[model samples]
Target: MRARPDSLFNLKKVLMNQPVSRSVSSQQQAAAPQSPQSPHAAGASGSPPRTFGSGHPPRIAIVSASWHADLVGQCRDAAVKGLEAAGPCHITHIHVPGAFETPLHALKLARSGQFDAVLACALVVDGGIYRHDFVAQAVIDGLMRAQMDTGVPVFSAVLTPLAFHEHAVHHQFFHEHLVHKGTELAAACVATLTSLRQIEALSS
Candidate 1:
């Protein structure tokens, strides 16, 4: 089936622009500038990237919130598309009750040592009276902590829009936006794992 117009537009944009790789490289460059001796560390061009380095296909876990499964599924599909574009990968799809639970689930996956990376996608919008701000922060923080503790890369596409109403127009817009975010997350996952391997090779 053909993707919706918004999803198509987002997929095209991600394919053309590759926001994830650029964002990662930018961060590296910023660090390079700080380390006087490695002024060109980030600028130096390297050989063409391999799809993936591990002899076996990489394993990825996708933890999604079920609260908005329909919309979240778009992100998951787009992410799978991006990952396949890079090369073959094994995916473990999962669903949790809500955005608040994504982190613990992600942590479990990361610690299992069964996945090369874990990606969490959720829509944490203001629910009339609840504090989405705190929930969003806590989930993000927990994801980061999980990665640091496990040495496995973790990425999040969890979005907390300041103003989100339960309407068709808003829903459609966010669904399409999620498609792009998914692609970005996939790109980041691949790039990060590759970079880590490169560093390991260098260190050894």
Candidate 2:
């Protein structure tokens, strides 16, 4: 795979900062604004307990759901951006017809022993049916199963919007959020992977 020149240096920087959960906790602490009622209160913070990012750059597969191609594409981009932020990763993309199908495709890739991480991105929206919920659950469950059964790390940014309407505000808001999610999730993935490798080394 060709190394993306612009992203390599920065990604290495992120990898060097491999979290002890300290930076993430600190970030959370800073994010909490002082309550008007109480100027200073003891604050609490945490990140996803899972450390997905870390170690050498990873070879990853990003799967996007096609039901909303435009929206899901943002996820794909965000993921790539995230991976770049973490380090120079080798990335490949797979487009599935909808969120429900992403897990299967990801499963195939994960089981192939070709990629270190698999990321599935999608937007499951309610269209006056129970289908979105069903698909969301199934896909998530399947991804988990694949990882557990294969020891392959699977990361998801597939979200079910609470109140997504065919309106401009919702679209714009979610799009912006998706970009952030992609970057953040990518960071999380790297952090988790690094931490896991760290523990594995310690145990050995």
Candidate 3:
């Protein structure tokens, strides 16, 4: 695919005021705040440990951008391989214009209730300006919002590099890096969904 000159600066104007929260543990704590007057503390009931069941396969959706499809596709391929290896499931791939648009599509998919989880992957790079940071933050934040609103688990493999140039060496390195990232994301997806199931089982 021919590289677009303006692609690097494409999402600079979009999602300039959003922030990506990278602290998962902190978010969890905040989500479940403890009250001093409560009769039972968090985890008061010692429930039996539950394992991620393999009987029900999860449905997953992967949304990727078309701008850097060549490199971005590598991430998707790795994600699929990893997910399949982790547990057999129904996986779907969706294509969008760019990273800035991934969240909306992910929201739609999550809301449709057709999938157990959604994963967004992209390569947002600085193009001689501070816009890349904004775009990346917005996309990630948007994904989180979608997850919270829909009660669905969403994963992100979006990366923003401080130094990115149109060079053969850089391209080769990031391509390999994305492969590892994809595997990590897949593992996270499976683990998270399994945990959610276990939590649901607690009430049942």
Candidate 4:
């Protein structure tokens, strides 16, 4: 599943060729005076980050599993709201039958070069008929492989709970939890993209 050397080189070239907005370039210059290794350089110095997609709205793709429609829907909604709040973005959502199908959809989207990032959302629970752990592991591995092979960033909101039951109380707890996780995923997605942009700027 490793990417060919030439493909990696092409990915690096594409990143370098991406346009940098004037505002982002200015922000990067402002932060240049700070210590290179400082963790708080961006925040403590009051300098804005060189965020990705500053030149244009980023294209994002989301793949969600529909097994537990009610629960998964909450996560998807929360994630969408969070991304919109962050900034302008073009989001495409696709639904699959279950968690096992999400990785394939994500891979296809990532390889298409149409999205800056991909998000996968699902709730993997023990159904008492098969090993949920194996399925979860495979899904995660596939997602990692997709990103690595295609040089695209992939974010996962796939959760595997040890004990889950069809009860009102359990549902309420998970509903709230998924919302929190979704929000966190949105933040991570933005932060990761911003960091990558900063790295690209530094290299250039």
Candidate 5:
């Protein structure tokens, strides 16, 4: 099924455009970056990335919130599909109470010593409460901090819109966006993992 136009996210548009990573040449591959860590160090703690020596498929956890069960479910499905299309990924799904709890779930799962990466999904829309912004910001910040603190790669599928009323029209829009977000996140996760592995190979 196709994602709704309102819901579909255009990753090419969403991501900051940059030059693609060039293939490793023997001479350049031999000349690795002087630093052991990349600028986008895995998580919030800033621990050096764990080098697995280039074998094994990375295990990634997809953490989602229960508040927007249906939409998030669709988003999760899209993510799973996207990840599968990319390659074999050990995807473990987890659920939090709401968007506010996504960061903790991501951190906890990342620190579990099982997952290589963490992907979080949530629809943090403004309810009647005046706290959606705070919750959304906190969730994003916490996820970043947690990853740096724990040294695991984390990707967010959580979005906080200025207005997200639960209506047929809004639902249609976000659903499509979720699919795009899923595809985008999947690509990022794979690229990030590959980059990390290349770095490790050079280090050794």
Candidate 6:
């Protein structure tokens, strides 16, 4: 598939106003203060403990697909909340036209050496095109390749459902589900980065 310059250009426009440190709204900032002692810092109860070995905060890049803007936004917002609640961290959020475009952007960010971790979020549903499976698999494979090529630790929250209809019921259910997935993604990111940091320290 050819690259969509227009979509990428629009993404650049969105990123202009979003600083690299954090892309959260004022409401989220107010809701999640920078506190290391928060109970949710270790992630949902019973999850593995999260430890930040470095003095500086971890820098994360979140690349989200905008096909389902409303649902995707819910996930993004929840992720921001989870990340902030985890502890102080730098986050950069970017948007792409759709899931197909996320891999390239994610790979670019991972190669830049500016972020500790990279994440891709999208809701790829079967549109009766019969190519949803292919697209989803391609996206996931691309993300994995990006991580391996750059060694920057890439994570995916991309969800591909077998059936998704344009109705209030499905929409509501998926919206709520994406929010939960987003939070889980954030927790996983924290845990992974912490473990990598410890391993690096030991190696050094």
Q: lDDT of each prediction vs. the true structure?
A: 0.82, 0.75, 0.80, 0.82, 0.77, 0.83
Tens digits of lDDT, candidate 4, 1-204: 988656644533343233333335777888877646565454666333333457568889999999998999889888888888878889999999999999999999999989989999998988999998899999999999999999889999998876787787668767877888788778778777777776878999
By lDDT, the best candidate is: 6
List ranges where model 2 is wrong by over 4 Å.
1-56
Models 1 onward score TM values of 0.75, 0.71, 0.73, 0.75, 0.72, 0.76
Model 1 agreement with the true structure over 1-204: per-residue lDDT tens digits: 886656755543453333322235776777765545453245556533437766678899999999888888898889888888888899999999988999999999999989989999888877878898999999999999999999999999887775676678677777888898899888788788788888888999
Model 5, 1-204: lDDT tens per residue? 887563323422332122334457888877986666665566646443333224686798999899988888777888778777766668898888888888888889888899989999888877786878888889899999988999889998888765676778677777777777777777777767877777778999
Model 1 alpha-carbon drift over 4 Å, by segment: 1-50
Clashes of each: 0, 14, 0, 0, 16, 0
lDDT of 3 by residue, 74-189 (tens): 88899898888775688999999889999999999999989999999898988785688899889999999999999999999887776676688678767887888888788778
lDDT (Cα, tens digit) per residue for candidate 6, span 1-204? 998656544443342222234358999989986765554544556455444445689999999998999998888888888888878899999999999999999999999999999989998888876788899999999999999999999999888876677788678777887898899888888888887877888999
Count residue pairs with overlapping backbones in model 1.
0
Kindly list the per-residue Cα lDDT of model 2 for residues 1-204, writing each as its tens digit: 887664544443343232223235777889988566432223523333333444566788888888878777887797787677665778888888888888889889999999888898998888986766787788899988888888889998888775577677567766777787788778767866776677789999
RMSD of each: 9.1, 13.1, 11.4, 16.0, 11.0, 15.2
Worst 10 residues of 2 by lDDT: 14-23
Clashes (candidate 3):
0
Q: CA lDDT of 126 in candidate 4?
A: 87
Give residue 191's error in model 6 in angstroms: 0.3
* Model 1, residue 42: C-alpha shift (Å): 14
Clashing residue pairs in candidate 4 are none
The positional error of residue 132 in candidate 1, measured at the CA in angstroms, is 0.6
* Candidate 6: clashing residue pairs, number: 0
In angstroms, how far off is 61's CA in candidate 1?
0.7
